[model samples]
Target: MERDSTAGGAEDLLLEDTVSKLRAGSLHKHELAEAMEVEQEGLVEHQPLEQDDLNFEKWKPKPKPKRTLHEKIDDLKTYLWNAETKEFMGRSGKSWSLILLFYSALYIFLAAMFAGCMCCLMWSISPYAPTYNDRVMPPGMTMFPHVDVAHGFDVAFNASDRSSWRKYAKALEAHLKSYDDGVQDRRNINCEGNTYFMQDDLEESAERKACQFKRSWLGECSGMKDKDFGYSKGKPCILVKMNRILGYLPGQGTPVHVTCGVKKGSTEGLGEVQFFPENIFNLRYYPYYGKLRHVNYSSPLVAVHFPSVPYDTQLHIQCKLNGRGIINDSPTDRFLGSVSFTLQVGA
Candidate 1:
């Protein structure tokens, strides 16, 4: 019976130890559960705070640094000629060279086209003849010793002053120098005065023959006999010439004649008018070819002499070309077929 009691006591002690170990295990599990719940709560709160910080950082703008003048100059220099990229004005050297070559070729093409057009224009036109002659039709008339005034040329001079008339005489002398007999005979032919000398053929030098107008034909007005041209004696000589028209003929049947008279309401009369070599332009000089064809052609001249112009008085004189085709009455063209001048002589 004593042995059975001892075994039962040992069993009771072993059962108590097992129960204590189970209770301790239960407490550890409960504490671990509570710690896990607190940790989950802390993670949720930290996640929202971290998200707010991320949003603030995303919306905030970065501040720009202020650059000094030297820094700005360096930036400009880099833009103009970048040492790092080897670029000039935002373009590489090779790129600029290609662009330059393209523009150069385009300009060269344009210049060549322009030159070709000019060459074609030059080839199309002749150098000897004019392309247009509309403005030069019918021709015009002019005079030498052409002193201009309000109404017309004023051939006024004091007879007592040699200087006053000397220039007029000199002008006449110079005008007649080309008409010298020796000079005319050398370069021109004495063609028939009443008919036209039409030359369709060109000479060996490719020129048409010109007519001779002798200086002696001017007679007293010629500078050979009277060097002063009567200016010192209060009488003056005036020369009249008609402008040449290319391929134009004047005076169909009758020869073109010049007639000088005192204009109406003249204060003084034009006294004792005389014309040298007659008042007509001989038909031989008509139908003038161009300057290239008629190289030595000299236009015929008619010299008018005023022997007794009233002294100390002004006289209005008009010289008109009387011809069928001439338009002398046109008020619009005062210088077409006529030339008028004022003459005043002082004793």
Candidate 2:
């Protein structure tokens, strides 16, 4: 009962002091109203704000502290010397050795597999004959005095231009270099000009008689007779050689000849064309067996001459090779057994 009286006395003194403050106008009317509102709402009394609580800068996000070089080194050292592992750099010696060994083994296995595949491929392929004769079926034909071999039989030049005409002459001379007598003697023999020379075995002489394709047979265009190859005289000569395939024969006693003429509308621009050595590729040089068997074998050549051509005009000429088993009319094979060239002359 005495403790209750003491508490009542203290509460009374507090009420008396508050009322005195309100009467003296020391306490604001809003404060008195707030105190009454708090008592009526039964809300807890608000504590006074601390200096730190009032400061707004303390509420902002702190920046991350930058690590110094020594701190970074220490962290690296700690990571390297962890409880479970110790490493020279980033990995343990054992880990590095294992990685190297795995890579070496993988490389060795890959190399062996590649070598085995190459061996299998080589075993299936033949050194003598091609596996697929896609381009070799009809035999590809080649022609000299070609402006560009990549462009396929398209030859054009100014008649008065020495440098332009000399290119063709140089090409012809280089092509005929393999026909030296000493070189021909090693692989070729005297063949009967009338018949096809066929050899079966390597017993007597493995070489078939290659026809003597003398440079003089080209007449005035032959380098032996005319060194300029008839280029400067407005008469440019062209040589054609058929690509040889092993065991290919044009047939028995069927002669292959080349025929050249101006195209339909180009006759006015170009005059008559003449062919040398009777305009034929004889059967004696048939069935060319690579460089190993017939080292000095020469393909029969025909030189076509454009005797006269008018100045400042382009002439289209078509040269057709007439023979058995040779394709002359294939649209895809423009230069197969026949070719077309445009000639231009200027003063």
Candidate 3:
């Protein structure tokens, strides 16, 4: 019985210790709740202050400071030339040098290629004669005082006007300047009148000698005798010459002659016409070798003189070349065969 009573007493002590631990735990939980509530109240109070600061900052934003003109120019200058970065015009010095070098080399190569092509083309061409003469075949005839009118040759002037006729006379004077007797005697040889002066052999200077054609052969129509070329006297002289072709033999052995008359269907009458020296182109000027070979070469001239053309009349005149191997009537090319012109004399 005594042992049973001691056991009951130990059980009561254990229950009391358990109850005390439960009470201590409840007090600690109550203190933790109070500390959490105090911290939440402090956070709630700071939140409104933070929101007011944000609203205040949004209401009035700080303005950007305005730069003066001098400051802006200074900024632009710094952008154009940045000394710290060693850059000019938005590029570093080394980068700009490389770009300039690349373009310079590219342009130099292109210029060299162009110069090389031109040199090769020039080397293939003959200096003396043209490479192709197909378009210039059969040759063409031209006249001095060549006044162009509506795609055709026309000579119209007042006979009494010295200013008008003086230009024609001056043109003739310039044309015949190379054919002067003194110039011809020095540069050319006097060949037979009706025979060809064939120069098969080249001279010591690697050139062929040309025949002399003195201005004196033109007689009264020559500017040497009459400075006016008969224009002031109402008698105008027109000089005719044949175009030169390389290695071309015109008229064969026969003499080429010029015949001028009123064009067909022309109402106006052509008065008396005269040819200086003769109406013929002498045979000595044939078989032209090129400009380089035929040095000092002068094409022979035929002066046609209108001794008595009617005053105040426009006469359509056609001068034709008549000889063997010379095509004088080409349908397609009017200038290729012969030359036609309109003549108007004013009082």
Best by TM-score, which number?
Answer: 3
Model 1 over residues 1-347: C-alpha lDDT tens digits? 88889999999999999999999999999999999999999988887555666677678798899999999999999999998899999999999999999999999999999999999999988666668777645557877786444545778898889988887788788888889999999999888758877776655237888889989999889878788888888888999988888777788856899998887665347768899999999888877877877888898999999998889887878888888788876678878888878788898
- How well does candidate 3 score on lDDT at residue 27? 94
- Write one digit per residue (lDDT tens) for candidate 3, span 106-125: 99999999999999999998
lDDT of each: 0.84, 0.73, 0.85
TM-score of candidate 2 to 2 decimals: 0.69
Deviation of model 2 at 7, angstroms: 70
Q: Give candidate 3 regions above 4 Å deviation.
A: 1-72, 147-152, 193-195, 200-205, 264-268
The positional error of residue 134 in candidate 2, measured at the CA in angstroms, is 2.6
lDDT of 2 by residue, 52-74 (tens): 98998989999989999999998
**Candidate 3: 10-residue stretch with minimal lDDT:** 197-206
Q: In model 2, how many backbone clashes occur?
A: 0
- The RMSD (Cα, Å) of candidate 2 is 14.0
Candidate 1 lDDT score at position 53 = 69
- After superposition, the stretches of candidate 1 with alpha carbons farther than 4 Å from their true spots are 1-92, 95-99, 147-152, 201-205, 266-268
